[model samples]
Target: MNIQHFAAFRAVMMTGTVSGAAEILGRSQPAVSRLLDRLEAELGLALFERRKGLITPTPQAHRLLDEVERAYVSLDSLKNLASRLAKGQGNQVSVAVLPALGLSFMPRVIAKFRQDWPETKVSLNVRMSPTVEEWVAGQQVDFGFAEMPVRRSGFETEIFSNAPYVAAVPSGHELADRSCLMPEDLREGPLISWTPFVAARHLLDQVLVTSGVRIEALCETSLSGAAFEMVKQGLGIAIVDPYTAVLQADERIRLIPFRPAIPFNLALLRPEFRGSPPTVDHMLSFARDLRDDVLARVPT
Candidate 1:
């Protein structure tokens, strides 16, 4: 029997009369009786005993009612879960981010996200850009933020930021007084640079080469956060993404625009294979706001 049959059976058992069941089910008394008959025949058990004008449930009906009630309870719970999910109240979200954004920018986004979705847990994975791209391509996380030029096939990517890289100089340094820095300006002091593997480093190298500027690096790091730390210690100045330079800028560091702009591009990656939940979309909204705020505050 189908759900109508089960519904009739439940209604009849609850009310103890076909007329009462009919009223509850918005069907005629004979329609409800027929449903009970079909259900009993399908189950191969007499569910009710009929008297001249009344009905009494059999022991078999009582036993079957227990299972039906449990099933209905489970169905109700499933409906509730679907409702919550549709409203963007999912349990948790997993995100992978490059260190440039993860160090400061992403934290602010998460903080703003929590204000609206405090109950949803957030799992933040801070990795290198390549690792972030791999995680997104492999569907290991719900979404990711990474450097641009993701070659993987299983991602829906959007360019989050395409601002120029900025020169990060230590406070009191000779170059700190310069409002903007060119490739040639780096020659005056030691330069802290990204390792050759980084995509931004390749772009910066292209600009330096095109301008016929070259300088030996005092040190190299794979992470912009580390580069910022090195710059903080007066070790050397660095050219870093605008996000990292703006957020990490403090009394110890100065941010200057880089000439012949080497564009620092960041991308937002979502797994092509998975449906994005409401929480993921909300988190992305927060990220967009943070990107706009940082870009607005960046020095020219």
Candidate 2:
């Protein structure tokens, strides 16, 4: 009939008497008997036989007990799983990230996160900013890091990093000696630039136009990391996000602050329909710390 009836049946079978079952269940003997009676009426099967104030389990009762015991085992396992998940143990955290951060910044964050939560697994998806936003909006991942001005509807965002872009110049280039590079300065050399379709590229173009600077385009790339690679090969100088500059800078390349500060804004996006788990919160804390550390080292 109900959990109480099943419980009574189980206890009586275990103890071999209604009085013993009542003692175990904190119920009166008559109450236990009534539970058994209701259970039998509901199932249309007799679960126990009683005579001269003694009770014995029916054959059907033993079969029902086996099923109930199996159900209880499964319920116990589900409870244990819930407890582990609440404690942030043995779970997976999925995150989508822009290529700029994924190539450099996020790996460090994940390394630090793993030190603290070794049992938690992480799935990192590296994609373009728009794709990262789409994954978050679609709930394909737990959360995402993308360039700001996310245009998706199904996710909430928090500003993760707000820092100015920097110029990555070959170490042998004359502009590398300058304290900072302005849009006008880039006109002196072939410039490795973002593709015209990227939002940051449009912003860079506006700044260049405002500064009355026109530079030769050496090549075009969609990824800041790719631009950094081009700079390292002495192809040309590139204006890149600070995260990429900070991690990918080498002896072959020099990082200089970019004037008119094209701010590279990054946001963290989480699905509105999903709740933040402890694992996600811990990972976010690590990511924020790394962001602050990198920003602090950004060329001013």
Candidate 3:
């Protein structure tokens, strides 16, 4: 019997459906079904009896699944070990970072990572918080760089910094004269917001709700850079992450500190307690170095 065939059978039996198995294995439904068919053909055992859109595990299937499951888990552990041995100190890192931070924060970290591990090739994925969380939780990425209060399951997290909120206003706007603005100051004028689902948007809503600021949102955009650009054009005022807005250095738009602090936690994460490949470990170590060096002097 083929090992992979057994593995597929185990996944299908455990998940109770081909679609669920496909999700875990990151394959298409038809592909997973084909694998299951191939497995049954090779083993000469009908592992599951399908009825009424549900998979019924046979007694024999249940008995065989236990051994197959253990074998696959052991193989996974051995694969991790062998991969680490094969690399023996390599400089390739695959990482996922939230789009908000990826724009400004990752460059400094990447530069430091490159300097320390000259051969290290760092690949950065810019995704939303949910996507980053899911990728790390799924063990699809070696590491994830993102704002904390995230929804990642089976992961370890370490906070690096508190990313503060800043008020972005046109250089000559009335509120621009003030060194800082209150949540109320935001509502008085047309307001710009990020996409409603982003962490910043949630934080903004929380701040507004707590402060009793029923600020009207003139527009919502996905990018802070774009929001700040609109503010610079005097179209409206925006509150955005200091990291992304600070990078713009748009003299036309000033970054003013805000009261009733709005902050997000930045963290480094890895899947919970799973042994990392040597390349993964080296990259993680270097990423922390890069994070510390860059975050320390961000001036936020």
Off by over 4 Å in 3: 1-90, 276-300
Q: Is candidate 2 or candidate 3 better by lDDT?
A: 2
TM-score of predicted model 3?
0.64
Q: What TM-score fits each model?
A: 0.69, 0.70, 0.64
Ranking by TM-score: 2, 1, 3
Per-residue accuracy of model 3 over 1-300 as CA lDDT, tens digit each: 666666667778878888898898888988888888897787788878888777788798888876675566447645755786688834456678887668776766677667667765566788777767766776656788777787757788878568577788888888878877888898666888877766778888888899898976878898876787788788888877766666666778877777777885777777776667676766566556655654453434
TM-score, candidate number 1 = 0.69
lDDT of 1 by residue, 209-280 (tens): 998998789799988888988999999889888888888778999998888888877888988979988988
Candidate 3 pairs with clashing backbones: none
Model 2: per-residue Cα lDDT at residue 245 = 90
| Candidate closest to the true structure, highest TM-score | 2
Candidate 1 deviation (Cα RMSD): 18.6
The whole-model C-alpha lDDT of candidate 2 against the native structure comes to 0.87
Query: How far in Å is the alpha carbon of 190 misplaced in model 1?
Result: 0.9
CA shift of 146, model 2, Å: 1.0
**Residue range with the least summed lDDT across 10 consecutive positions in model 2:** 70-79
